[model samples]
Target: MPENRISRAKLTTDIVLAGVFGLMSLPFALMGNWADLVAMALFVSALAVRRLAPAWSLGIAWCAATVQMAALRDLQFYDFAVLGVLYSTAAHGGRLVKWLGLVSAGVGALIATVYLQVLMPIFGDTSGLTPENLIAAAFILVASLALLVLAWTAGLLARSVREGREVRRREEVANRERALVEYRYTVEQERNRIARDMHDVVAHSLAVVIAQADGARFAAKTRPDAASEALQTISGVARGALGDVRVLLAELRHREGGAPQPVLDDLGELIEGVVAAGLDVRRVETGEPCELGTGHQIAVYRIVQEALTNALRHGDPGAPVEVRFDWTPTGVSLMIANRLADAAGGPGTTATGATATGPTGARHGITGMRERAQLVGGTLSAEPGGDGVFRVVASIPAQPRSTA
Candidate 1:
């Protein structure tokens, strides 16, 4: 019923106040009579326990009230302790105890009126109570009931305010926790997006550079001019890769673009660059040109780029690679294929021809390609076929035609 935690300092202060109230009431009880002395003692005891045990405080105040009635005395100053106990019962006690405080106020008023106005004087000096005495008794009953009920109501109101504040504090804490979880989920999605981007850029560039390095190595003795060209191609590919890596790093710092995203229009230069590195890449096109959103164009470009890059990395260097595009009103279809291994033996090496090799620990190429396709409302599959060949097929759906 009391506050949940009371510091040692606060306990000491309350004890001192209780002692002072008792000492102040001591003289009035001594001068009035033995019965007043007993009533004051019980009322002061109720004050001492009011906060620590509010229901018990109320019970003790009722005992003091009964003692005052039996003593047949006028109300003493110490009887004010009943108001303090009534306040505590509502402020600190449970529901049952709070109702008991209100009941005590009504019942105590009735008992005190009858004893003081009618019984006390008839036994002592008055032969009987007059009409004026009865009226005074009614006034005393109303006044005492008002003060006691006011004290209890004040306690109930204070309790309501404290409970409201506690509820608001808990809601604020829950909101903060929900916001933190959403923030973490958003950060995780962004990180996965960046990882896919890095894989596409770095893997495609490495595949081109490796093919060029192989060309330069195999051509150095017999064809000096061819070797020089291969070196030039390698240099260009490396520079592009470096620039792309710089752009990705800048993205980590939340900077705007430092490199342009590849689009379908860039496919020609992309195919030409691969062919220059010694892979025989043939291009085929059908149907009329169609407009596409930037996101769809990027997906188309990257799918072709990654397919060709895989042919250079994992297919025979002298193998013929074919890329075809079929555009319709609804969507575009794409296919890319290359020999998986040289006719002579092993992967990437041709019979009577040279081999191209590069770093080979990546498996995210297909995943990155599939993610790109999905972003454009499309599908893609890359697989090896029965004739020692690898193939890629992709279907990219188009958006509604824009008139603007």
Candidate 2:
């Protein structure tokens, strides 16, 4: 692509140079006088090399033509060559070159008209205009005006094309960057879906198994029959949890509609699983319950689950976590807070809590949580609490875009 671009640039430069010099050589090439043959030869040769040296080619062509007119001692019809040089310089050269080329052309025309009409006639009638003069003058004037307009218009068009190409290149780069951002977003969303499913399955399953094991351990000597029943319940809960996990894993892998989508109603089961783990939770609700869209409900459920999980990880086991939901006039607000138990801190060691401990709390996890919230036009915060408590708070706007 780079080589091709360089080649095209060279070709465009050659075309511009050729057009400029072709005009410069126009007047000398039009003459039929035998003495003008040498000048015409020089002009033609310069035209061939114009692409290599435009200014030199144009200047040499104009000078040779002027010299030939001087030698003939007849400047008649030479004004056309000067006009051609002026147009060429204006189209291809810089501001100074354009001004000088035009001034020289205008002066040359005035001098040629004077010499051809007055001075040259002292030797002989070399005016070359009489019966044919009016028609020749009209043709030259019209042609020069037309060529000048054409060259200026062509230069404008070339500039516009260059600008348009540059704009398109920039837009193409921007589009590619936008596509990459969207792809990364999709991947992250899918990964979050998988992670939420894993937490739902594993955490709940472990809770039930641990509860049964604790019960079995306590009852092993005195209530052997109750211990066997607890073991049976463990088997039942494990099978059920495994089935749920299998369905979730299948959905995560996108195995052709493996499970029905879970919504707000399914949150009760999630809460029950944590309760079965012997964690004390108090859930308070406000406003009449209404069916929410699956995606919104899923976002809500995940936010709540994450908050509760953090509570379990950081709060003392004996402390109760409070879960509150309020559907306000503007949006929904969810808050989870748990008081820390004094026993959680070892002697001379302060309980820093999970928020300060691991990657999930300090690094990528909170960032991911915030991302999920923002994706649904919501806001989330995790902060230290005075009086030995930690809080997780989130607010999700109702009719998301309406708030925006």
Candidate 3:
């Protein structure tokens, strides 16, 4: 609809311009110069289609000049329309027409010089080709050519400016599309990180709470004090889980509202919570600890949390879990092992009766852990052994802190 409106407007503008040119040439029609009137009418018609059909406009202009030369008439005011036709050919015409406009400018200038200087005087007077007349003719040809070429050059400049604007507009659109794609990619990555954090926090906490609650229920009548301690552990674990959930929700609501994440120092509290849930955990550290960047630390912390959570959920209740960390100058290696709940294999279980941690088994939790390890330039593996034990081993390389 808008395109239609613009086209109508351009057509209206061309009609008005043609009308004005015709009105200006009305004097020739009134003066009874029939040939001049005919040429003016043709030139006016060319002006009407100057932009809409530049090739046709150029043709009409040549016909007007031919009629005027055949009558041996002097250049009239409406003859200026030839300049407009040439300009339109360069500005609005296709490749062939644009070059043709230049050729027409040169040839028309030469022809006009000959018709006015030689042919007109031959028919109207007895003047011969004197040196002064020849020199004047040369000046006239140069001037006419310069004027026509200048008009064409102006049209070419306009074309260049329009094309440049079009190029800039396309570049802006491409930049916007690129930025939108990057934004979506960043958003997806952040969402995955949040999901991993939520799983680590909620899953571990619920597992501990469930164990404590079950123990409390079984020991309530036999040992009231033991039941009370179990209830306390459950309460603490639940409250901590609630707080972590609130923080995660805050981060969801406001991108920059994330709380400080757990680091290596917080592992002690993690282990203590699991122990209070009635699982025995043994920790062994070998070699000196090395510094790790924030991202690497987060990866290490989440991997350990997930591994311990899996053991608490799937391992034998009476068996002790072992966590070993071997640190070197470059990085740390971690191994966690626990006895299986059942010694005989069954559905959803390995040969050792431990829950399968492969893609088809405990997929989500193990996959999350593996992704975290890889994010920090590390590797992780989880499998159940023939000895009825499930093991998780990871090697994480230290990374340098990023500068601001």
Candidate 4:
């Protein structure tokens, strides 16, 4: 509900409570008991502001009680409004007012005992301090104190329940915000991984198909056998690209992980495929291979795949591409280099092995390779060497396979 409406509703309820008590005390005004009627009016006013202004309500109740004691008026039904004021002090009052309510409960009980039992009997009955009357007065004092203190305690219990509910609600909202942040982070990581896979599969295959298609078109009239071989390579590369794309699509449809990915063991087939498309590749390995986790292996495979694809698309067709792997006890380092085509052999080439407008236009291939290396706690750099050769180098640390 709107705040103003809620406030108005609370005011209405308090008014109804005050009206009911005022009607019950109407006999005081009808019987010409003016002092009692004035005390009742103060108590009714206190009840009306009990929730809306608890401190004011408490002050007003004290005034009414003082007037009744001063006038020596007997107890009336409207006096019960004191308990409601005490309750509101704890339930709605600020810290200072809440403690004051407790003090009022104790002090008001003591005052009532003195006024009713000690003073009233001396004035009305001319009674001396008898033992039996003293015992009865002591019992009334304890009962009156308990009643006032119980009302204040009930209000305190209500305050505790309300505070507890507010604490739980705040905790629930914080948990939801934390969950949303974690979910977004997971989704972004997954998207980057998928983008890397798509680039590796599509870019590499298309480069091979373009190379074989060009060669087939040129040699179709002169050498039919060479043309037939080129067609076969193109067909195989296209089919493999199609299968990889389908697997990626399937992974998107179902979130249960992806198909088996290429690893270090698959490097031979990768090199052979490019060689069939008419680029000479020389691969050399040194030292012993270290074990690596599945995620690290994927990073390595994609980095090498993207590097080779960049070379096949931008390197000189007549020159050989050199690939080397140096393995140590801790990690493996890779280097792939190829002579740049005549058009790319310029001083204006950027550090990413590309010109202002190099092959694979936006250079997402190099950026993706760098991101993949970083994901596996590795590093990569691609730049043109002083000898007019474009080199892609990467270093990856070994990690234990996960059992889960």
List lDDT for all candidates, in order: 0.79, 0.61, 0.85, 0.85
Q: How far off is residue 101 in model 3, in Å? A: 2.0
TM-score quality measure for candidate 4: 0.87
> Least accurate stretch of 10 residues (summed lDDT) in model 1?
352-361
Task: Itemize residue pairs with steric clashes in candidate 3.
Answer: none
Residue 262, candidate 2: alpha-carbon lDDT: 64
Winner on lDDT (1 vs 2): 1
Candidate 2 global lDDT? 0.61
For residues 291-364, could you state the per-residue lDDT of candidate 2 as single tens digits?
44555676678776666665555466687888888887666788888765443443532333453344244234
- For residue 303, model 4's alpha carbon misses the true position, in angstroms, by 0.4
RMSD of each: 5.5, 6.8, 3.4, 3.3
List candidate 3 segments past 4 Å from native: 1-6, 29-34, 124-132, 348-361
Clashing pairs in 1: none
Candidate 4 structure quality by residue, lDDT tens digits, 1-404: 11112278889999998989899877854564777888899999998988888888889899999988887777788888888989988887888889999999999998998888777777766575567767878988899899999999988889899889989999999999999888878777776677679878999999899999999999999999999999999999999999998888787666556599888889889999999989899999999998999888888888888888888877788999999899998898999898877544567455555655664542889889889899889999987787879888999999987889
TM-score for each model: 0.73, 0.62, 0.89, 0.87
Residues 101-177, model 1: lDDT tens digits = 88887887787778888888697577688898889999988987788889889988887887898899999999999
Arranged by TM-score, best first: 3, 4, 1, 2
TM-score for candidate 2, please give it: 0.62
TM-score of 1: 0.73
lDDT of 1: 0.79
Q: Write the per-residue lDDT of candidate 3 for residues 255-362, one digit (tens) a residue.
A: 555589888888898899889888899999999898888888888888888888878888888999999999998899999998878745567675433366543334
lDDT of 4 at 129: 57
